[model samples]
Target: MNLKFLYFVIFMLCLGQNLRAQYVEKEEEEKITTLYPEAVFDSIQAKKALALGKGKITGVAFTKTAPLAPRIYADNMKIMLFPVTPYFEAWYKLRNSKENLRKRRYVYMSDAAFRYRLEAISNSVGKFTFPDMKPGKYFLTGNMSWSSTGSYNEHTGTSYGSYGTQADHYEKRYYTQNHEERLEKFVEVKTDGEIVEVKLK
Candidate 1:
């Protein structure tokens, strides 16, 4: 192949790759403005209604977990759970005044409501909101559980059994114990808010 033509082809390939990268970046920016079904509060009235009857107007928040190294957008942030579940109770945790997390905050939703015949899962899942947050932060963390309970006496444990002769006793045991209300895994989020809108090509 001619040297000039070969160099030109190589240059074009590099150019195409660069364009693809730019396209990806542009796409990410567009996602920032995109809206989720439950996240969308198209009108002021709708926004007001959701906040109404709800205790203390705590802000809403959301995070995207997929697309590994997920792209985060301010617009993708949601103030409400898309689909509410009565099986759990959700709450927010702000930074204590003397805490190192004064600027950083968290929220949790535990499953430990026993009053209504509910045995809350041991873990609690939470969404975080930041009224004053620094930009360029990549991830957020929290935890979740399938159930929870507050009563201490309700704690339960397992029992064991044995078989065979006393001289040669073979024993077996089962783990049927339930633990006290304890926190679980910490989930990290890349974005703190909603995704911004983009100009469609």
Candidate 2:
């Protein structure tokens, strides 16, 4: 009976090892497939930080072309702008007064406190008109994430092990940030050439 029990334990251990190997292989294949998209879609542009100040700063402007009434209806409106280029980058300083460097916290894309742009824009300077947002202060910012489709390696096992050896390895690095500040607030029906400029807060 003892011999039979010992044999069963050995068989179960071997089965577990085989299952782990298969699962690892399946996960690796899925990871590889996910990294590459179906086709070569438009490239994602990288955004620089926005510089903040008390005075005017160069930012994209937007205007409403159609006659938007207080209680009017519209199906669609065209927005004229430049194609979004990755080279365009800007940064804004949030505070007007001098503060401790350590007290400053760098806000990232995932933060909930930061505001966001309802409509998406590809370029830096362009006219963007969307369904009229409610009359209130809104935050405008950008989010970005990037990854490299590659693998790396490092030494494994102990430096002074009985059978020291090297092994394959892989790593993933993630980077993202956010820019947020109160934008213009609108109360009445904005005219056709209502220009909204993005400036340092």
Candidate 3:
């Protein structure tokens, strides 16, 4: 073969190999993001995995007003498992700030760090499970709200004086107070693969 043709063929082969390597690297990165989305935003979980271990956490959330009484099921409850990190602590503080109330209108909406935290919804029977969590301190929280309606009577009085005589008129108005009752709890998880029971009041 001519030297020119040989050089052209070698260049083509090298280009193909380079393209293949790029494709493989991209695929591996995408897979990691899919499995551990938080790794893209922060290295906390990755560092924890390297230092400690990973395991599963399962539990149930219920409400019990009276002791020894059958607990009320808290179905479809949202449970969050947040790693104990400075980022998480700051987020928690921001979440509870009155000045940021307008910004935090949606409880489900969160940043990448918070969103990647392990989360689960309780089943019909109030059972929830979070599997494959890195071994570390995790802040557990759950919230559930129900609609409530109540009625109250308001009284209004007016007085008038004319011709040295006083007269008063009174009125009563009935009002309905429609509000929501929210149940929430904050707990700490110290062990992995251990069941943590949370009671909401």
| Winning candidate number (lDDT) | 3
Candidate 3, after superposition: displacement of residue 89 in Å?
0.5
Report the C-alpha displacement of residue 20, candidate 2, in angstroms.
49
* lDDT score, candidate 3, position 101: 65
Over the stretch 43-158, how does candidate 3's per-residue lDDT look in tens digits? 56624632433455666777654699677666787877667565555555655667556444323323556555566898877788766654566666766543334455444555
Which candidate, 2 or 3, has the higher lDDT? 3
TM-score of 3: 0.45
The runs of at least 3 residues in candidate 3 whose Cα sits more than 4 Å from the true structure, single-residue gaps closed, are 1-43, 46-56, 63-71, 97-110, 147-184
Compared with the true structure, what per-residue lDDT tens digits does model 2 show for residues 164-195?
A: 76455444544444322222322221233243
**Residues 18-101, candidate 1, lDDT per residue (tens digit)?**
877743433443212221122222334323322322122122222233556442222322222211222221222222223424
TM-score top scorer: 3
Candidate numbers, best TM-score first, in rank order: 3, 2, 1
Instruction: Give the better candidate number (1 or 2) by TM-score.
Output: 2
Off by over 4 Å in 2: 1-97, 101-110, 114-117, 122-125, 142-201
lDDT of 1 at 56: 22
Error in Å for residue 98 of model 2? 2.1
Looking at model 3, residue 16 earns an lDDT score of 82
Worst 10 residues of 1 by lDDT: 114-123
